[model samples]
Target: MAERVVPEGQRRRRRPTKQGAVLSERLIIDTALRLVTQHGADALSVRRLGTALGADPSSLYRYFRNTDDLLLRLADEFIGLAQEGFTPSGDWRADLRDMGLRIHGVYVENPQVALLAAHRTTGRAHETAAVEKILGILRGAGFPDPTAVRLYHAFVDQALAFAALDAAAQALPTPAREADEEVWLSSYGRLPPDTHPNVAATFPLLAADMRDSGYPFALDLMLEAAEARLRG
Candidate 1:
């Protein structure tokens, strides 16, 4: 007897599990996200997800090819959440600022997801839409094709990079996170001016500023540079 082979571009029929739950792609993605959020990204395996959804582990293949494939879908979903309800105000700087903040905020809210998927290229619908929107905004603001592409690349990379960095901090255990935050005050702020002049001088400002995510400040600098390029 020969084993069965499913064709490409088609899925096997989905059936209810022993627990009487009918699983779909959306359900699977949602469950996976919840699992990642609750148990960390390492818990996003098929067996765990199956247990969470009360479906057999093999049933997930009907929707996703593998864990990697599911991860891409999850990444795209994060992009979707960030872009949801976003409408451009036609001011290029303001639009970009809003979008950048949106991405940062969403990633911070879902720290585990951001830590795992922020660096991935999903190449899916939500990601495609975000790319198109950014390019359109840049081109509409009088940036030439090459310049637009360059700025687009820089803008996205900056957003994701900072998001991942901040998310990593956010994902840290409470005690570790608190200890890290205390470093500026406990160590850097108390530096001797004679030996560490710059540190001593900047300690006041650093103490006030280091408590927050630096994404917004970095984002503003990037936008300012882009504005300058547009002016030239």
Candidate 2:
């Protein structure tokens, strides 16, 4: 089967398997991404990836220097996904909010990758572009150069931090997640008012709140605060 690849300059020739299938860097990364998507974070081992690709595990080294290298590739793809369909409206606040949510969207959709490397730096091409786009958004909004850079730093870190935390929660095994939900519904919701009046009063809303992620609300609060700085 033929695959389309945008060649990285001076990269090695595509490696071929005994079955006559060809593998390129994009193919390897795409296969690994599918493996992570089908299984969870636990499915990213080199052996399993090699098995899925129908190649010897050692052959994967031709594309990636190691498992960490593979992860960087995956993370870069995720960064690219975060900006998919993004267009910068002249309204910077709305634009930034959309960007934040989209970045979080990718992480939530691919919790395994978020859990593995959301907070790690890839320094790969896509990641570099993502950074440049964010900084450009901030600068275009009329912030001073220093403020723009500082804001960009905090903005990205906050987005990734929340994404990672939310992804970890989302990635929990079903049994464990159910157990936590049970605690919320039964244990905490049933707290004795004399011993825990505050929790008792808030339990209903808290339990309801636990049904959905808080990333969107948290993102709003962050953006609101950032906008406040701009107004000052």
Candidate 3:
């Protein structure tokens, strides 16, 4: 029997073709991402996605077991973007800040997706890879494994929390933001000056603060606290 040789192009084509019944998981994930970005996580369903994709709903079952599985994959896709774009330089502060801002950028870019993925845990490959990379970066900066993991989790949690909260605050209707002001004016404005001296004294300064100022200030405070703890 003669040996068989397959051309590079043919081999590549055949490889994909061989995945007969298996759906394009990547395509499905990308479609899911767009759907979540445009509508929201609640807008996603197997049937709806199939209708949007022009495939039978059952066809998605070949790739994902259920909507939860699909959601997990979507989370992976979001984290994967961060991992792909992040480059670790030797400077830990610069590197960590870049990483935090990158996570913020991704969530801010896709608010709906951020809403769904922020608090959920998806023990997927890309998510684990992201975690490992963060740990590696911190450890490379001379932090012990326990310290690195502690800071890594805190950094990630705070970034995502701020991202979600920031999105929600921005998405509030005009009436809602206005209503918040009404409460501030009616309730806090009426506080007895003698009883609440500090509140009255700083009322102007407090009122001067906006959501834009508050979220980043809080996130920076959290980061600073973490650094102090690590230093001690």
Candidate 4:
């Protein structure tokens, strides 16, 4: 690579790929996303990243110091995507429900990114904006400042918690995930009534419903309870 002039005091790294494609921070994140989506989160490594980029692994060091840095950036990007098209209509329940769905939907689509963000707070611009929006909605719906903040915390955490659960289900390899449901159908569903009356009695319902990850049901339950609190 030629001695390219990079701007001073900027952390953005730029270089050319083997196919003469320009690489930047966004390109790196985008490529890393593909790697994670296709091969699972553990597949992300400097050596593997270079192969995907058609450049030496050392080149990635110019941008991300390590894998955590890369994961954080990707998670932040997911936050951006999660809140896309999320507009509050002033009806707190409906509006917040839609926002929750959007958040969970993105997590399902990008399980690897969701895993990275499951425990850590990125404190990035996108995450900050999402918090502000949720708090504003709660306050606008007649919640006192303290109550709004508390409810906002619970609401967002509930969505994220369920998202992480659903994403974990999705992250499982196809055969492994299928086998789980098979256990429910074949083993749990076939338990003898003598020792496991409840399991035998409810086996049909369990087999019919156990296939879902239950994020939607969980989201609605939390939101309904929150609404009841507001009414109370």
Candidate 5:
């Protein structure tokens, strides 16, 4: 039998074999996740991701059929983050609040990615797990199965819808924030005294910090309602 021979220089190199060099679907998804989070969804493209990963753009096709496919994975990443953060301690109301706040925090952290994942539902692992957790909490609290499912839908949908809008608002560039403030200032500064009495009198509050207060306030209101339902 002939003995196999090793090539020179290759014997000592730590470079991965062709099989090892092949990236996993997870790796590609992870790269796309970070890219979308930092750069808006529009900023993500197979070519750019390929360039960043030092692989040919076509290599991405091996993992994702197209950019939309990659986006769905990115959306799953957000759900994964929410699942990782979720912890329900058998208290339905508290669990729902915790989930809502956690989801909000996840979106706020990756505002750009939040915009992409906000409304779309892939029913992937992270999302499915999160739903199961919520259902478990509701069921443990004495709700019927159908009620638990309905509550789960409302809770997750409201949280995500609000998160998407909030993130899109917050994700605006610095110049955009400044411009928005300037527009409010200009518009409020010119309000008439009689016809828009309330507007004129409350211009300061009307134009006050629109980002932080409203988001948490809205979340609190939803949680409050959920708690009330559970109590009833």
Candidate 6:
């Protein structure tokens, strides 16, 4: 009698491992995320993930084709988290702002995941749904297809880019992160008044603002530009 050969990424039946833990795609992704969060992105590997799951490393291929596939799924999972419970208020500016903030907040919360997945295009379910929702919002607000797509591209890319940048800072070692936070005060704030007139004059404001993520301001600027285009 011949044994069965399971094809990659097409295994339909969930099975329990030797340790009695049932393996599922969501469970695998969640475990992967936990590993990345606790041990950094370098912790994401076949051996580590299998050990963490207490399953055979080959079992993961049932859900994802490879490490890269798992990564895309993880990226889409972050998108799912961002879009979870989100409802469009029908006001284009407000909706865009809300969505932008949500993306930034979620990514920042999962800094390791953001650091790994922010720049990758995950054409998975959640990513597709988000794209659809944003485009629908823009089109519903009177923008034509081309304009809507352009706006959606800019909006999403800007959000992801800023989120990744902030996440990188957050992912730094504690001392390094603290040092970065103090730069506005220790370096920029203490610049010679005559040598750096503008910075010296605005150091107080910079000190206050530099402590926060700049995503909100950047989001608003993009929304404002979109609003202007819509108006004209």
Query: Which candidate wins on lDDT?
Result: 1
Error of 2 at 133 (Å): 1.2
lDDT of each: 0.89, 0.82, 0.72, 0.80, 0.73, 0.88
The local distance difference test score of model 1 is: 0.89
**Candidate 6, poorest ten consecutive residues by summed lDDT:** 1-10
Residue 228 lDDT, candidate 1, scale 0-100: 98
Q: Model 4, stretches more than 4 Å misplaced?
A: 1-15
TM-score of 2: 0.87
Flag the better candidate by lDDT, 2 or 3. 2
- Among these predictions, the greatest TM-score belongs to 1
Give model 3 RMSD, 1 decimal: 7.5
Per-residue C-alpha lDDT of model 5 across residues 1-232, encoded as one tens digit per residue: 1223234333332443233554556766777777877787766787778766666666566566677767777787777777684555766676778778888778878888888777888777877787777888878888788878887787787788778877887789989977876876787768998888988888887778642536567767866776687778
Displacement of residue 71 (Cα, Å) in model 1 is 0.1
Candidate 5: regions farther than 4 A off: 1-22
Candidate 1 vs 2: which has more lDDT: 1
Regarding lDDT, does 1 or 3 come out ahead?
1
User: Which regions of candidate 6 are displaced past 4 Å?
Assistant: 1-15
- How many residue pairs clash in model 4? 0
lDDT per residue for candidate 6 within 83-180, as digits (tens), equals 99899998989998999999889999989999999999988899999998989899999999999999999999999999999999999999999998
Instruction: Indicate whether candidate 4 or candidate 5 has the larger lDDT.
Output: 4
Clashes of each: 0, 0, 0, 0, 0, 0
Q: Tell me each candidate's TM-score.
A: 0.93, 0.87, 0.75, 0.87, 0.79, 0.92
